[model samples]
Target chain A: MRLLIEIEVRFGEFVLSVNESLTLDGVTALFGPSGSGKTTLLRCIAGLEPRAEGRIEADDQAWLDSKAGVSLPAHHRMAGMVFQQALLFPHLSVRKNLLYGWRRRGQRPGPDFSEVLDALRLAPLLEQRENELSGGEMQRVALGRVLLSAPRMLLLDEPLAAQDERRKAEILPYLKRTIREFQLPVVYVSHAVDEVMPMASRVLHMDSGRLQSSAAARVSGGTAFGAILLGATLQRQLDSRLAVFCVGNAEVIAFLDSDTPNAREVLLAVEPRDLVIATGKTDAPLNAGAMDCTVRSIGEDETSGNLVLELAAGSSSFRLEHSFARHSDTVLRVGQKIRVLLTQPARVASPIVQSGTGRDSA
Target chain B: MIRAVEVIELDSLWLTLRLASLSTAILMVLATPLAYWLATTKAGIKPIVEAVTALPLILPPTVLGFYLLILFSPSSAFGSLWVQVTGQTLSFSFTGILLASVVHSFPFAVQPMQTAFENNGRRPAEVAQSLGASPFDAFITVTVPMARRGFLTAAVLGFAHSVGEFGVILLVGGNIPGRTRVISIDIYTHVETLDYASAHFLSMLTLCFAMLVLSLVFIVNRRYPIRT
Candidate 1:
C-alpha cells in the first residue's frame, strides 16, 4: 500500500507544505528537527489537524480532499495514533484501556485479544492501574491499545521520546517486534537519528516545515548516505574484542569493544564517512570489514564538494562519501568494480533482551 | 410540643430546600454544554460569553435582583410572554425566584467544570477518537470520567449558592410566606419583628449547614488532591 498526500497548513507566519507519495512497505521514518513539521505532518495524516487542506489518499480511499470538501473525521480515518505521552485512560485499569479500542472496532477484524496481550507483554499488568505502570510499560500498553484498534495504518509521533535511556532500551525491542509481527504500514515520526536508523526501512527528511527528500532503505535501514545492518545475528565471538555477524549474504567480522555478550542479535549502523573506497583490494587491518562492491553511481555533495558513490554489495546497496582530492588520481565509472572497507567500528545497538542491566537506571 | 409559629418557620425552610434542589438540577443540565463550549471554543466572543456567565459572581446580588425584577415586570417582553403562557407575571412567583437563583448561581456551576475540561486537555478526547470512539462517545466515556471531580464540585457549589440566595429572591419573588419566603428571608422576618430567639435558632442552623457543606468539599478535595 502507498499513501498519496499533498497537504498544506498555515499557522500564522509558519507554513507546512508537503507533497509526496510514500510507499508503505515497512517502517517509514519522518525524520527532522523538533520544529521542522515532522509531527505536524503525522498529525495531518491521522486527520487530527482540522485546518490542514489538500488531498490525502491511502490506496484508493480518500481521507482528505479539499477541493471535494471531503474531510473524514478522525474516528473514521482508520489511522491509529500513538502520541509521545502514553495518555492512557487514567480512570480505567490497564486491561480496560487495552480493551477500549478492541471493543470499539465495530465488526472490523483485529488482532486477537490474547495475542496482543502476549505480544506487548501486557498480561501481567492487566489488573494494574495506569499510575502503577512505569514509563516503558505505559508506552508498551499504549502501543498495544492502538494496535488492538485494527487500523489500516499506524502513526507514531515520537513514541519513545519521553522515556529516558533505560526506559527506551526496555521498549525498543518490543516496538521492533510489534512492527515486524503486525506488518502494518507505519509512519514513524522522530527527530533522533539513532531511532530512525534502527526502525526505519525508509526515511523522509523534513526541515523548516517542508519535505526535503525521501530515500529508500535497502533491505536493511537508513537514508542514502547511511547504512544500518538490521537483524544481524551473532555468528560467534572470537575473543573479548572480536565477533562475527552474518549480515545479508556476507559474513562480516565486527569489533566489539563493549560488553554485548547477551546481544543475540544486533543492529549495526555505519555513517557515510566511515566507508572507505579502494580501487583495488587493500590489505585491511583485522578491525575492519572489507567486501567487493560495484559502483552503481557517483554524485557530488553540493554543500561540501565531496564525491558520494552509490555502491552495491551482494544484495544490499549503500553510499560512501569521500573528499574529491583524495580520489583525484583515479577515474570512477557508474558500473566500476571496487572494494569498500568499513573502517570504523559500527555502533552496536541494544539487544532484544538486555538480560538484567539498564532497567532501573533512572 | 411544636408551636404554630415554628411550623410556619419549618414551611419556609422546606420551601428553600425545594427551590435549591430544582435550581441545582436545572443548572447542572444547562452548565454541562455551556462549560464544555467555554472550555473548547476559540470563538472571538468567548470572553464575552465568559464575562456574562461570571457577572453574578462579582455583581452585588441586589443589583442583579433589580435588573431581574425589571425584566420580569408585567410590561416587559419576557414577562408578557410568561403571562400569556401561564396567565401570570414572572415577578412575585416561585418560578421567577427559581430563574433568578439559576442566573445567580451560573458561575458556581460552570467555572469548576470548565477548569476541569481545560486541565483534562483535548489530547485525551482526541486519543479516544483515534481509538475508534466517536466524539460524543469519547466525551461521555473518557472526558466525563476523567473530569468527575470538577462535576462534583460544580454541583455542590451550585447547590450551596442557590440555597444561600437572599437578595435576588427578595426582589424577584417578593416575600409572601410559604410562597417566596426561603430560610434566609424567614430569618430576616424573625429579626425584623424583634424575635431574636427564633432568629438565633435559624441562623445557627444555617451556619452549621454551611460549615458541613464546605467541610465535605474540602475533605473530598484533600482526598483526591485535584489535578492542578
Candidate 2:
C-alpha cells in the first residue's frame, strides 16, 4: 500500500505536522519517543483524528482531503488500527470479539475467519471472556480481531508495549507469522529499538512532533543513538548468560542479562556510545569479538560535541561515537580502516524478518 | 358491593402499571440519544442541555406539572395541534398523565444512562468503528451491551418513579376513575374519604413494590458492576 499524507493536527499547545509518502509492504516502523506524535500520525491515517486537516491518500483512495471537504469517517476507511491498550470488547466472549469485525467486514475479500483463529492461536480461548485472558493473549486477540476486519492495511500502535519481555517474546513469533501469512502492509508504531529492528523493514524517526529523518539516513531509537542490524540470526548460547548472532558475514556476541529467547533468528542493535574504535588492527581483549571496519563517514554531534563516525563492516553499516577529548591520538577520516572493539554487548531481539531477507544486510 | 370496591381498586392498580410501563418505555427511547449526546458532546450547549434534562430532578413535580399543563392547554400551539389531531384535551386523560409521568421521570431515566455512556468511554466505540462497524452499529453492538447494567437500573428507577408519582398526576390528570386514577390517586382518594383501610393496603403494596425495584437495582449493580 502506498500512503501519501500531509496533515497537521493541533492538540492544545502540541501541534503534530507530518508530510511524507510511505510505500508500506511489510512492517514499516514509526519509531519515536513518548509524546512524539507517532500515534497521532497513525490516528490520522486511520481517519480517527478529527482535528487533522490535510490530504491523506492510501492506495489511490483519498481517505481525507480537507480542501475538497472529503473526509471519510473512520469506519469507512479500510485501515484497521490496534491501540496501545488491548481494547478487546469486555462484554464479548473471545470468539465473539474475534468475529465482531468479521461479521461486519462487508464484501472485502481477505483471510478466512478460522484461519485467523488458528494463526493467532485463539481457537482454545474462543469461549473465554476478555477478563480471563492474559495481557499478551488479549493483545493477540485484539490483533486477530482487526485482521478479521479485512482491512486494506494494518496500523499497530505499540501492540506489544504493554507486555513484559517474556510475554513479548512469546507473542512476537505469532505476530510475525500472522503478518507474513496475510502479507498486508503494516505501519507499526513503537519506541523500543529491539522491537523495531526485528519487525520494521524501514524505520522513520520522529522527535518533538516532527519527522527527523529516514532510517537509512539515521536511526535514533528514542533517547538512544543506535543502528539496527536487521536479519541477524542467533547462532547459539555460548553459556546461559552469553549468546552469539550472525549479522551479514560478521558474528555478533551479545550478553544476555535475561533468559535467552527460544527463537533461533534474532536482530541486533548497537549503540554508538557502547562501541570502542581503535586504529590498530590487532584483536583487542574483550568478552565479545571485534571486527574490521572501514570508516564510511565522519561527523560531529552538535549537542554533545562527540565525533560521530559511520563505519561499514561486511555488508552492514554501524555508527560509533568517539569523543575528541578522550580519543585525540587516533585521527579518523572518511575512508580510514579501523577495528571497533565490542566492550558492550549488542542488544538482541527475536527476528521478525523472514530468512531470505536477512542476507540483505546493507 | 364488595365486588364493586374490589373492581375499582383493580382498575386503579392496572392503570398505574400501564402508565408506568408506557412512561418508562417512552423515556428510555427518548432519553437514550439525549443521554448519549450529553455524555459525548463537547459543544458549548452541553451544559445547558444537561441542566434542562436534570430540571425534573431538583424542581418539585408541581412546578413541572404547571408548565406542562399550560403547554397542553388549547390556547397553546402544541395543545391546539393535539386538539386538532385527536379532538380531545390533554388534561385529565391517561395519555396526558403518561406524558406527565415521562417528563417527571426524565432524570431518573437519563442520569444512569449518561453515567453508563460516560464510563464506557469512546475507546471501545472507536475500536469497533476502526473494525468497520458504523457509529450506530458500534453503539448498539459494543456500547449498549457493555453498559447494560446502567440501562437496567435506569429502567427500574424510571418505572418505580413513575408509579409513585402523585403530585404531577394530580395536577395534570385529575381524579377520573378507570382513566387518570392511578394507584397513587386511588390511595389519595381513600385518605380524603377517611377510608384508612384501603389507603393502608395500597400504600403497603407500593412500598413493597418500590423496595423490590430498588433491590433489583442493587443486585444488578453488585452482580456485574459497571467497569471503569
lDDT by residue for model 1 (A1-362), tens: 76788999999888999887766756776655447788888889888898899999988799999999998888888799999999999989999999899999988987998888889899999999887899999999999999999988889898998999899889999999999999888888864556665565555666568774332222343344556555566787778877777665565666674755455566566765666676554866678776677788787767767776766766556555578424568888889887777786565543322211211121
Instruction: Give the lowest summed-lDDT range of ten residues in model 2 chain B.
Output: B219-228
lDDT of 2 by residue, B122-152 (tens): 8999999999988899999999988788799
lDDT for each residue of candidate 1 in B96-130, tens digit (9 for 90 to 100)? 99999999999999999999999899999999999
Local accuracy by lDDT, each model: 0.80, 0.80
lDDT at residue A75 of model 2 (Cα atoms): 90
Residue B55 deviation, candidate 2, in Å? Answer: 1.1
CAPRI class of candidate 1: acceptable
> Clash pairs of candidate 2?
none
Q: Residue by residue across A106-218, what tens digits does model 2's lDDT show?
A: 78898998899889888999999888888899999998999999998899898888899899998889889977899998888875665666666655667668874343333
**Stretches of candidate 2 above 4 Å error?**
A215-221, A224-268, A271-362, B214-228
True lDDT of residue A169, candidate 2: 92
What DockQ do you compute for every candidate structure?
0.44, 0.49
